[model samples]
Target chain A: MTAKLSPRTEIRLAGEGGQGMILAGIILAEAAAIYDGKNAVQTQSYGPEARGGASKAEVVIASGEIDHPEVLNADVVVALSQEAFKKFASSVKPGGLLIVDEEKVDSTSAPQAIRIPVTKMAFETTGTVALGVLVGLTGVVSREAIEKAVTARAPRGTEEMNHKALDAGFTAAEKARK
Target chain B: MAVKLMQGNEAIALGAVAAGCRFYAGYPITPSTEVAEVLSRELPKVGGKFIQMEDEIASMAAIIGASVGGLKSMTATSGPGFSLMQENIGYAAMTEIPCVVVDVQRLGPSTGQPTAASQGDVMQARWGTHGDHPIIALSPISVRQSFDLTIKAFDLSEKFRTPVILLTDEIIGHMREPVELPDFKTIRSEEYRVTAPGQEYIPFRNESGDVPPLANFGVGYRYHITGLYHDQVGFPTQRLDEIDPWLERVNTKLDKHLDEIALVEEDYQDGAKVALLSYGCSARTARHALKLARAQGKKVDMLTLFTIWPFPERQVEALGERVDRIIVPEMNLGQLAYEVERMAGRKKVRRVVRANGEMVTPQMVLEAMEG
Candidate 1:
């Protein structure tokens, strides 16, 4: 199903520092801007801790120039940790999509969330499976664009596994829709 | 060139190489360390030198020395490191050395926050050197502009024979966007040329123009360089006759070239009564607010200042006369707002400021417009 997105779509990917949410945000933005010909701006913020502290990456995808780069009110927000969910679930716009990690974030605050075991999927496949899940569920960018972006950005020797993870994510999303 | 996603700091590093900058000396700091990291990898591939100095003070000294030795040089740092660089920045100003200093500003009177963004250094970029000397500072609001302005900083420094500051904040420094860079072969950098012969070369000559051609140290020309007031021959002099001419030339050089130096973008609507004036990241917010205001049928003009130094007094004064009120939004309390008030009158300017490491939001600007 093709996702109907606004002219300007603001997405927030948030998790603990070492969860690679920042890299996932970068990959998502690259898929939209570089591979799909849309304009994108990505900005990030995190605590001083090298790992485990709260971290977030915001991506603004637009058909026109992106001003005010940060997410004012997110159209899409993916929270991979309980802390991230608690902190950012309120920031999602009304009727906006909220995706959360099924096992990591146990919260009823956002009942409309599409729950998925993204971290477990990554453990079974590649470290960037969250990116796959997000794109597969939202269709923010085309599948081919994300494939090319993952190939270009994923680490050497991890491309094959990452592609498999993306396929798995598409399947999971399909199952969730049913 | 095809469009590629690039961060502001990485664009700056590559832009320096494009600008013919061959020497880089800097200590790594958050939000700006990417510049040094990228330069370390890229500078050597182009037959340039990159050195990680012991501290910011030494980094400043190293770039100055490299520039004096006839290479376009640069250094990038955050708040604390930028603070350490002030004394040498002044020295470079006094000596008329051409170099670029990139301050990817983080919050600070001291080290406030390493990753958070702030525009608190606006005044520091202008007067941090502790003298009446003229300074040139440019701020970029986007990734592409960061690359473009870095090259402009080098060109202006070499043409005017003074240190130029790329005064960016952590927001723009770390933000990533798609940019299609120009062809490297087409990029050109301004070079210093000595017109006078070996015996007639004067390092501090002000006879023809405010700026004189500076001779490289290893070149055939020999001259003294000092931080103290110097005469035409570059020797220190306490004589008022010798010092007065030097002061006039150094301080008035940028003023004389204000037309060329002051870079601003003006977006005016027919008969718009209110205006938004901002720079750097805050300009992005103001632009967003302008759109929101206009969508609600409010008439507003927007002016984005790329050149933050020399104050752009003429433009602000004219804007003040045309607009009923000017809303100034920045990350600091009232740094540029003070200048706006000075030009536009206190009653005509409204300040929207935030210094708690968060951006001045578009909502804040919208509220300011209402007020």
Candidate 2:
């Protein structure tokens, strides 16, 4: 095998019921692994019910072969629920950043937290169904290594919505930074 | 340029379409239903056939019948339904049919978890059919692989003239990922030997005697095929001598070609002392464990078995001599580890069993390697 080194990034999302956290992780991983020709591993954990249960999804994107599908301490965690925030905030590495939904999380514990209205955007986009798009957009706005992932993982024939959702997240993040 | 976000199940459906699979028969099960659902919608567009069988047994039978009718066919099922389809799988082996079965495996001995990730079916995919038979099972770690490997499963089934199973877990089945839809091209079918121009054709034998070149039914090859021991002409035979070799030949063709079928990925295997071995989703965890072990200055290597059937003896035997211990972590209660210890000898094999429907994490494998 010819040797080529690919940079690696781990993306994680955690939230309560119906936030599409798992969908976000899968879209990011698959887009990179399949479309960008990177190696990706996507995994998820859900407590029980379809409504109001703790849910978390992790994606490990690597240019080379992915050694681990399980990400113990994420380089990035997007928490969409208060329960998820309390659960996943400490799970991120000290240097890692935490993205949370402003409505759900108080944002007092996290030293470096970026508040994004993922749930509100999800509702406005297409009610609860567009949560997948919200998560997809977050992947696009990550400013990490997942931009390639957003373009790669969009639903077929939904390029317009994918672009709009991603731009929304990016603009939202940029505004928050300012 | 269709960059659609597809679930692993939907990808398998597209793969079945791309592989020229004209027939699909399956019952809806959690995680695996998307495969059936997608095929249901797409098959008609391509003038293919799709049937939601009454149960998995009928589903398996329908697919086999479709294969015999000169159509590439498949079925998808989860743990509970997969168990229902085992007997037909055995029948397919005896009849030497070419087909594919996708098992989006959920946790189970019996409905353990309806929609959770589990590698518990590793050995079940090999031996669940009962009786001795060779199996070709390909597993995918990513959603894209669910597509690519589904196509490969069909190719192998046609190549070996045996039923191939794409063993995927719920995680890989439900997880959506980006997949590059390859340019559509005509996939060539293997040459079939038939009774040409008013001659007797035996569906069970070929010129090379390797695999009986399968002829599609109603293709001018009027041959009878029954599960019982049969003569060269495809007629059932009662003679023990004839029966033994018939079984032997089917077994030998696959066994002799094991090298061609065995697929494994060796990571840092050179001059390694400790062996961290795994397959399916567990392979990823083992890779992490191997890295952690290496960082601690421990000599470790990783052996990932993609082709679990026929148990890559050559690789295992060679690795067995060099490693101090082979640490195997899986989501089941020591199903595959039993075979590993059997083939690699008992002294150095270790089993890290996890049966709670959760993944076999890296910590579990690392601790076992250190232990």
- Which candidate has the highest lDDT of all? 1
Candidate 2 residue lDDT tens string, A1-178: 0112114566677877676667667656655655566666676778658877888888777767665566766767778778888877887776666777878789887757877776666553321222233333344223333445555555677656655665677566556656
TM-scores, one per candidate: 0.97, 0.83
Using DockQ as the measure, which candidate wins?
Answer: 1
Which ten-residue region of model 2 chain B has the weakest summed lDDT?
A: B188-197
lDDT of 1 by residue, B1-371 (tens): 99999999999998999999999999999879999999999999999999999999999999999998889999999889988999999999999999999999898878788889999999988988787898999999999999999999999999998999999999999999999999987997656656345567888996634688888887688789999888888898999998888888888888778999999999999899999999999999999999999999999999999999988999999999999999999999989999999998999999999999999999999999887
DockQ for model 2 equals 0.30
- DockQ of all candidates, in order? 0.88, 0.30
TM-score of 1: 0.97
Query: What 10-residue stretch in candidate 1 chain A is worst by lDDT?
Result: A123-132
Docking class of 2: acceptable
User: How well docked is model 1, in DockQ terms?
Assistant: 0.88
